[model samples]
Target: MSVQIRNLQSEDVLTYSLPLLLGDVRPPLAESKISVCNRRNNTSMSWPVYNGTFKALVELKPGENIIELMFYGEVVELVLVYKVPPLTRFVRPVYIKCHDDPHGDFQGPEDEDCSAESACQRIALGAKLIQTLTAEKLAEHGFGRKTFLLETDLDAKAPACHVFTSSLSVACAQQMTGAELWLKFACELMSAKTFTQKENCKWFCFMSFTRYEAENDSLPKSHIDVLKQTKGYAALGGGGLALFSTGNLHCWAETLDQVPLRFTDTRKIDRSKFMDDSAYRGFYWANYSTGLGSSLHELGHTFDLAHTRTGIMARGFDDLYRVFIVRPLRSRASSCSRDSSRLTTPSPYSSRSRSRVASGNSIGAEPCFLRPLPTRLHSQPSFPDVIHIEVGFAQLPTKLTQCYTVHHYDGSETQTVVTRQSDGTETRSQLTLSPDGEWERKDVKINQLDAGKTGMQVTACRELPMAPSALPHSAVDGPDSVQEFVLQGQTPSDAGAHWHRSSAVILNYHKWFNEDCEKNQGSSPEITGGYITSPCGLRLIELRNHDNGTVVHHWEFLHDDPPTEFKVNLDKVKDVLPADCVECSVMVEDSRGNISKKKVHFDDL
Candidate 1:
């Protein structure tokens, strides 16, 4: 492919032409097709050519005019820069790392071996903890995605190390408040001496204070003023602004309250004296210096997280020294049992923020609530349409011997729930009523509900047996109050599993069985039950029903892959179950990619 360039003058259109070549054409067509491209904004235009070359006309405006030749064919793309911007610019993510240090502050002497292995492990653990916390917070809060680098640079002169925010904004804030110095203090204290440090070296630094007057300037009031902006500048305090990063500091037990401790004779002191020191000079590294939490506390502050009263990084005094030594708590040997298990099978740990809280169970307590998983009913691509029905009475009656009927959405008689005694069985005994002020509330269940049903009416009546030793007259009427509910669901199928499609599910109500046996000579009463002719076999998965209530005639269907080939009558096979139930659910599984579920409300039963 090749490109061509052309120049045009005012009042004239110059046609820039380029050749469109593809494959191995011997003397290709005179004018071929090509595309024109604008390098400035990465836009392009394409056109077909009949000959070896294609042309685009350009009318130049003013100033320094530039034109470029470009080619785009089946074979390749070609571009020639004919214009350029005066200045080019680009931006990239910033990374901070240890720069140059003229003095070997961090480097060890030729034979120096201060337990490097343990120190490195602690450092690595600290870094990983920081990264983990930051990642978790970012995920929960939806923060912008950007990589942050944690670089460690050791200071040789002062034995001081700090976690500096490379961002200028952070640096400026530090300079204005001396926060960086405090941060260094906190981190050094937190990185207490390891076993190796305690066994081998006397790691120490020197601190000095100087009073300087800035000509006619105010004197520094305290050492904190250098790190913090205060009313006056009286003095500048300096020295080894450092703390033991690996082990405990050795100080006289008698003067644990001293600000800056100095060993009169370093060789005369022993480990016991160091272990008993409770001295802390400054608000060094926030929680890190205090040793109240792991590295997470310090890391939280680095991420701009503030102290909270009840969080993982809650602001609490770092009484580690007092907790460990002054109190002289028992020291148990560390165990690998818990650590090994954790390392092998890690599980998610939950930590709450300021406002969120977690609840736990104590003695004589139960869970607030329970949530069961939702069951599937249909395997079809879509959900089954739902139709609900309710049965109720307009008013209450003096006596309770009336029946209420349930109605479907289509205004048809769906089911009947009665409050009466039949066959020497007192169904009214199962009915409950609650009195609210002057009104009586009675809620009952109706079973075996259908899609379409007519409205039901309750009539008042009086039954009595008056004799020398018989019952007295009694009036019958509707209950004081009533309410009902119903549920309906269906499944879709494909044709071809069974030559004659037939599906059936048995309904058994233990309460009805016992009631009928005791009242009717052990003969079970016939309830509504049947099957629909489906093209293929159907599967019944689960059954749902309320306790102590009549069962509703609602069910779930299992869908087969490619839909089972069958024609089934869902209504003909439906049946009402025994028992007074508010709601029942069923889950069905078919030879398909999904599961089917159905839930029916028995309030209308």
Candidate 2:
């Protein structure tokens, strides 16, 4: 059998379709597989074949991408190079309206208390902030600045967009999920055709004001789910951005399909806090007079920029002027190089045979650089050693009690508490610490402290044990360093007699460490010295029914700590199957970046 590539030229491009054709492919081809490996990012995608043809969307990096096509036992390699294009600018219209008023009558922009001039000042300030943060800096990297135009109708009885009413109470406003509200607004815009059909203008930004009170509010999980579901909505083709004004003390933002939807609390703004050279501060200035700092930060996330140590992307909304002038655009080459090291390693239990593919061709066999894993786990499993906590005040009338809930990076939690008597005496409780030497404090009371204020401190440390095994001196074993584990399953006692009634299956996994290998140390220097700890964090768990090769449930945790055990729910599986659907498989991965697989029958689980 032979493979061919189509719809590809030597010129630079943004995205393209990678099509492969299989000719004279024989029967046992059921075992045949097709994979596309991106050498630049060290990422790969498996293409499913239909009618001897396979096609997949290939988004290219800024530079060259050495993509390898492997079908059956043959491997064909080619280079798809991309060059940075000229910066493209986009201007999205903004709409503002107040949904609710805590006092009595609602006021439009024309009202003396809510004048159009005042709204214009805030909108213009936000625009200046965006231009200062992006404009020239991003233009150098082939990315353009996104500006907003406030479209206001002050003379009209009703605003351009109706702002739904919400109560001022935090609980009342929070009960209405931001995603639902954002979706409602987006659907209205979609129906209005607010987004043009221009391909280049894919991003739309919408700004609105609400009378709801907010304090350090975070978007609900429903927002993330909405973004995941309606990632690329309507004519815009890309998700949109929304900035809502609530009387919140702080502002935050999140991405929906890389589109940033940010919320700013206008009540928290203190114009006095705006400093011309304040961007150099380590903490964000949440009290900026114009409330533009947080707005810029949220917009940065839309560009995939992360928090840095000393830039606009850094924590703390303070020092905007300095951040824009001092911080340089992140180097693409360095970021890509770093990501290439942690590219998803092949799983040993994956059905696609890597052994044959690895030996069949010498095209892309070289191993990329791998960072050393951590020796000891910490509060942040991804970090070698670090702890994060929040401290605040609470009041109690009689005996004051404070509870601490410590969370480990590995998805485990422990709790501790302290109490103060009415007579001013304090009692401390020992904390249940994780083996990784990390703990968190929770439910603190302001009146419980010895001084009747928020003042408390605790310190503890332990010597970590030596490495379990010595590091190897030679070349490390690539992705196949560890062997697969045997997965055993059992039917839940709660499973009803009817097949449809059974919603979940119990899964038990053990034998994580190899019997012959040292428990504390990794097998190779690459594994031992990598950013991961000895008992690698659990990365992924997937359950698939064997009858028709359909996946029933899948869970993946990246960067954050992974769960050691999983309870798989089968209610989402739509396929109708017989009671004897026996062939089922489970896949798992550990913090050490190794994947394993196991198979079991329905009777076994």
Candidate 3:
């Protein structure tokens, strides 16, 4: 007869229980043997027949999981398929005003001094300008398309404004203000309700305009702080971007906080006489056009982009001109690419000099009104290296070994063993790495008959020295060392000796066994019991005596954490045993995977 699968069917879940039975044959089901294999990943599990049935929990990968079942050397196959869930994206817009005037209302072109037809158009133009220059570059660089959308709240006329009553310079703001404070202020002012909500909306673009003197400009520090805070917050759920506008270069002081400023006169100059120094140079000085360029650069930083040598993220007007002016003209032989042409021809700015300044251009008949400027190149960005260490346990019959694996981006790795000396000093020994990039040590021993626990530790580094003087004086700044406890004991002091010869053997143990042991008895560290926790739970096995003490009945139990007082009934196994059975043995396993056994005779019944 062939192997028989009793409870499982096709189309099972990624994680489910599987039950199997030996052929449709004899009275003793103990002879039935089965082996399970995950054909897709080449992983397998085996189980010995227990009583009249066999069962195990199986987990499959996302795609097709081909499971092979072998019973009595006969093979059968089953397939299970799982699918990944779809991703949802959302973009939120936050308008912020950092100015000295609290009652100043946001005005548009339709308003007396305003030039834009509507506030939405003004904000939308900024967003479009940003997308025009960055969308293509980000895609070509393999960072994937932009996943954010900018939607304006038109009915809400004025943007949320944060007033600063005191005189604060850019340097002072950097020293006093933090990103967390800015986000808190923005969230409160904007009435941002969904930040902590369950929805997928997380990315927020914060556009801020300030009326303070450009010399005292300190918004850069705030921008950096906001990005740092938002990135950290994103690790949990939400992230944000801060875009600051300082109005136009004309409103700025000649020198801000002792730094010199340079300006170029663009009035009535012939188109053919245009030179490289035709634009202004001041810290954080940008008219509408340059403001958009600077805003795009800040937005790039929020996207994990580094400053390039010559793109929008590059320093100074020369780089911005290359990105916003020269690059587009060179790419298109005739008319500017639709985006660049939109800026020069129809003009998104209003029909006024201030409006032109806001757009980073001067009023002129010459197309591409912005001219290149002289500026120095900035230093390239730098990144630090990191290493990760992982610890695990490999269990066998007699002993348990602690395994350590150190991973680094660079190929090189080193291992070190630390030992405490008799004179209260510590000594270190370097170990050679195995072919598989792992190091294992069997320092903790298991009696297999007693419940006990022990601790182990290992240190890993990028390099080791042949002489003591070569070692770093301070280990804190050097390689990493990890320490954890290893449990090798059983619970319920009399677990093995409690089994009685009855219809059913009921075993009761503490549910909060490990937690209570750690907190009250100081047996080990406080650990939340789970599949990965050492000495996770207890296991029980039953064996019935057959011909010459050959085992006939086998049963086992494995759990993360048992109840405070739990009982296991074995009536099913008792009914399957033969009347001639003379004796039986029961084994109790502890959370540390240690097993202890007890035997009882039929006469004891």
User: Which candidate gets the maximum TM-score versus the true structure?
Assistant: 3
Better of 1 and 2 by TM-score: 2
lDDT scores of the candidates, listed in order: 0.24, 0.34, 0.32
lDDT of 1 by residue, 1-605 (tens): 44433222222221111111122212445434445444444444443333343333221222223334444444333332221112111111111111231111111112122122323323333332233233222222222111122221111121112222222232232233234433443344335452112221111221111111222343222322221322111111112121122222111111111101111111121111111111222211211223223233443333222232222333222322211111111224422122222222211111121111112111111111222334566754885677876779576433336555432222233233345333322232222221222323344543223212422211000000000111111121112111111111111111110000001111111111011222322222111122111222222222334342112222223222212222222332233333344455443322211233345443322
Can you give the lDDT of residue 148 in candidate 1? 24
lDDT of 3 by residue, 336-442 (tens): 22232222333122334434443334433223322233344565465676586666966533422233434222322345555543333344455545445675433
What is the Cα-based lDDT of residue 2 in candidate 3? Answer: 57
Q: Which stretches of candidate 3 lie over 4 Å from their true place?
A: 1-87, 98-120, 142-147, 151-181, 186-191, 194-209, 214-238, 249-286, 305-605
The TM-score that candidate 1 achieves is: 0.17
Minimal lDDT window, size 10, model 3:
460-469
Q: After superposition, how far is residue 441 of candidate 1 from its true place, in Å?
A: 57
Query: Where's the lowest-lDDT run of ten residues in candidate 2?
Result: 497-506
Deviation in angstroms for 51 in model 1? 81
